[model samples]
Target: MSAMEGDSFTLRTGLPEIQRDDEIEWRFGSSRTRLTRIAVGNITTCNDETFRDRLQLERQTGDLTVTNITNEHTGVYQLSIIIRNKKSTKRFAVTVYAPVPIPVIFSDTSQCALSAERSSRIFLCSVVNVSHVTLSWYKGNSLLSSISVSDLSISLSLPLEVEYQEKNTYSCVVNNPVSTQTRHLDIDQLCQIDCDLCFDSPEAVIRLVVSALISVAAVAAVVLLVNDIRRFGRTQTMKR
Candidate 1:
């Protein structure tokens, strides 16, 4: 089973009742370190630093509940019972995952303005500081590709191609066993103008303002030159 950090989960021993003189022992981790034992109406708990004060065991049913689980709590847990001089054991595998962060989608349209044969548009989906999660690209309701990572301290990224003149819905999805997040792509809003110039960054806005001013100044200069030429022609005619 899977759990997120700070959550609680139960591992069932599947035993309905404990008979008198029957012994039950709960162990955890890769080495099967003993966590707790109950026998003859007495309970003994291991003072191990990993499970100290964080685990509870049912006396009658032998079920275990772990509270405030952390990444270090991920491992195999075992329940051993002895009845009628016979011993039986069961194991439960637990996986604890960190919370997945929301993914950011970036459009790389630098070549969108080039010739049709040479231009290609790409979208990248990225998430930071997540683990045991998958980042995926979806076209409409179908999945295109996915990338999975188990390291929580690193980032993950997935990419998809956006064909020119291709009309379809796309989205980036980031998910773990406990949670999911999604970001939709607005193709129309992004491709309304030249893809290379579609982004309204501060630098792009400044360049646009400068270009507009230069165009206005050039028109004013042309209008003044035409007026000067006309005035010169009139002065020459009057002198004649």
Candidate 2:
């Protein structure tokens, strides 16, 4: 009467041992990464049912093989072993998460549509598949403030202040447990049209006045020439 048990001498708690040139197949990635290590219990001793002879029980460590892991290889896995006409099995679980991608910020700072008075221009932050992401604004590499987005998406309105608008490099860092992504926003001064100098200056006013005077003089001269020709024709007709 031989009884096989997880403990007492038939199976030991440890990694499987393999001989030279022996094929050891370690399966992983049913739902997660491969196994790094495994723990097993001591062996259990037992007697055969025939009772003709004493069946010596010996626990052996099973051989394990590892392969390179990838993102798609995420899932539960199991380890199986066969010893002396008996089979045993164990189970493990795994989880894989995606890394965060780089964060991009878009701002409306062109001169065509200027920001409203006393209001900041809107800047949008966009990240893909980063649910519940935390967005932190920074000047250079130093952290300024962190804000949590309740939804997957949110827009940040950045007022063009004297200090911040002049900064050379403004950055946004987005992070999660899996990964962190950062992006830099360059704030440049809008190419402006100086209305006081270019449009409403002394030179511009003088040019406008000269153009109006030339137009009036041309019209008056044309009118007087037409009247003089008509009066000369009438006097010649009376003489004839």
Candidate 3:
């Protein structure tokens, strides 16, 4: 079983109620060092640096629980019970993982326009410093793409391609056993214009418009000057 850091977990023995005469003991780690013991209506807990003030045992049953679990507390645990001089042991394997981080979605076209081609816009979803998690892209309720990793301390990324005028809905989701996070992609915000030279920001659009007007005015002035020169030359030739 797996659990996130700082979370609580329980190790169930599935045994019946404890008897006063029965003896119970719990051991932890690879070396199987003693963690806690119960015998003759008395409970004795290990004061090891790893489990101090974090271990609990049910007095009625032999079930064990640990709170505020950390990576150091991850290991194999053993429970030994002696009933009528017969010893029975059970072992549990536990794994600890860091909490999943909130995923961030990025796009190369955040301030660009989209073309008719399907690959004109590319979106990337990423999460960093997470382990034992899955990152996925969803279009509405449909799953688009997903990547899963086990116990790896690295970032994960998933890419999605969006086409012009073909938007349904899109989102990125990152999740682990303990937590889940989601981010939605707004197509309108990403592709403000859908032309060859689309402007991302309103200020950029304004500048483009102003530049175009200036160019038109310059062209008009040049045309008028050429016309005036041609007319003057004709008059001079006639006069001569």
Candidate 4:
């Protein structure tokens, strides 16, 4: 079944026809006093469809599509088939739940290390409008773990660590009584490498400073070469 932005879901059923003189009714609510909604298939028989009646057992038949279904629409739907005055019923239950939202990623930092250097990413998937909760962690599309934290206000933390910091995606899913939420955490090890590769050695500050100056000079020379080529192209274009 697929759901849309609105609180709607469509059910595709395999059963097409019910025996003659039989009726189908959708029932819901665990408690009898809870007030449930019933949308019967409005059964009618014979070729002309003349046996249809709102009440009384006049033999019902037909296919129906129920729309605008709400939470109260959830419950047991039974098909009562009557043949030769003998009746048999079959029932199915439905539960309505909202779609899970995208989670928010919160972390103080986004770096980690493998051999000589290290980085760490912290994340928590916060969700609302839920009662009992279950949390799951994922690496890319694969499931890592699933845990239950019944209280809604409780928080779930996921820590990601790796060797030789690189780009990795971490996902967390939060499922509750009312809805579900998911969030992703991304850590770039290449950036951490940039941090390490761009820094100076404490023991040799003078040499580090000289090395830094040389690197800047090299970058500037490359930029100047590119600019000179662009200027030469423009000059040739003007002459042409």
Candidate 5:
């Protein structure tokens, strides 16, 4: 059985309730260290301080529960039930894993976009401080690419390329044995970048409007100077 850390897990005895004459014992690990034993309607727990205050036993059901499980709680558990000289043994294999972290999708133009491929952009799906997880890129429901990390607490990145006008859906998913986190691609946001050049930018449009206004002002000034000169010449001729 696989369980997430900080959660509770129960090892069932398969019996609805414990009988008065029945004896139940639960052990842990390869050394067969005793954890709990029920005998003669009495329950007893071990003094293993490594799992201090984290073990619970249901007196009526002969079930053992571990609360707030951590890496130390991951191992094989053994259960023994004795009734009328008949002994039955069961073993449970448990694995505990951390919660999967959310993946972030961002543009990676530092080196990949140096070709000036304005129509297409490079993006990366990344997760930090993660281990034993798989990071993947998916186009809609189809898998595009993936990368995995094991045993090392390192970061992971998966690259993907798409057109600026892409209409299809995409998502980044990171998952472990028992947990998964997904981030949907917002083409208009993370894929959004500066215009191909200044000509298509809002600043460029503003500059064009300013230049037009300046040209009109200069033309008006020239026309006024020409009219003033013509009036002066007429006045001089009339006076003569």
Candidate 6:
């Protein structure tokens, strides 16, 4: 069984009911420390400091629930049941994983436009403050690259290079044992190479727009002036 940290997880007993004369015990962790036990109509939970006030053992069905679970609570859990003096054992493997963060896709060339030397535009897929997760890049449902980390997987950013005219779908995904998050690529938005960047500054862009607008205004003024001159000439000819 797998669960996310801070969420409650339950281990089902799979029994319809527990008889009044049965003995049940649940132990957890690497040391197999005794956590809770029920015997002949009596229930008791041991103070295993790590799981204090978090272990709930159902009296009717012998189900065990761990509340507000954390990464520390991930391990093997053992359930022991004794009925009619016959002992039966069942074991459960529980893993608590951190919440997977949404992967981010951004153009690596944002700081500078692509140069003539660069054959392909670069984009990066990244995640932050995450652990125990695999980060992968997919091109049209096909896996291109993947990287995983043992503890902190935030360093597992993946990079991809493609042509400026790339039209194929791409996505980045970050996943753990229990959760996943994905981000899709927008080629037009992230992989674009604006020729206007050749001007090199925001002021240059403003100047270009202003110059085009002035040219349009000058053309319109010239057309109006020519019309007025023709109208005046027509009035003089009619008076003659």
Q: Tens-digit lDDT track for model 5 on 116-235?
A: 436677778899999889999998899998898888899898988888679899999999998999999887765345332234345546876898899999999999999999999999
Each candidate's number of clashing pairs is: 0, 25, 0, 16, 0, 0
* Residue-level lDDT tens digits of model 6 in 65-138: 99999988989999999999999999999889988878878765443453544546778898888788889999
After the best TM-score superposition of candidate 5, give how far the Cα of residue 131 lies from its true spot, in angstroms.
2.3
How does residue 193 of candidate 3 score in lDDT?
39
TM-score of each: 0.75, 0.38, 0.77, 0.48, 0.77, 0.76
Candidate structures ordered by lDDT, highest first: 5, 6, 3, 1, 4, 2
lDDT of 4 by residue, 75-160 (tens): 65444444456756555565554455565654333232222233333445555554345767788899777766543444455443
Best by lDDT: 5
Candidate 2 residue lDDT tens string, 1-240: 111111111222255563333221233443323333322334322232221132232223453321233333344445555444355666544333344568776644452234223223344556655554577777777777676654444443332233323545667788754457787765442222211112223554586688889999999999999999999999999999
Which run of 10 residues does model 4 get worst, by summed lDDT? Answer: 46-55
Q: Model 4 Cα displacement at 97 (Å)?
A: 0.5
- Which lDDT tens digits does candidate 1 get at residues 1-240? 999899999998788998878999999887889998889978889999988899898988878899999999999999898998899999899999887787887765665434345434677789988877888999889989998877547888787877655778889999999989999977666655445353334555577688889999999999999999999999999999
- Model 3, residue 104: what's the lDDT? 86
lDDT-superior candidate, 2 or 5: 5
Q: Each prediction's Cα RMSD?
A: 7.7, 16.9, 9.0, 10.6, 8.0, 7.4
Clashing pairs in 1: none
Query: Regarding lDDT, does 1 or 6 come out ahead?
Result: 6
Off by over 4 Å in 4: 1-20, 23-26, 30-64, 109-119, 131-134, 149-164, 174-182, 188-240
Error of 2 at 62 (Å): 6.8
Give the C-alpha miss distance for residue 30 in model 2, angstroms. 9.3
lDDT values of the candidates? 0.82, 0.46, 0.83, 0.48, 0.86, 0.84
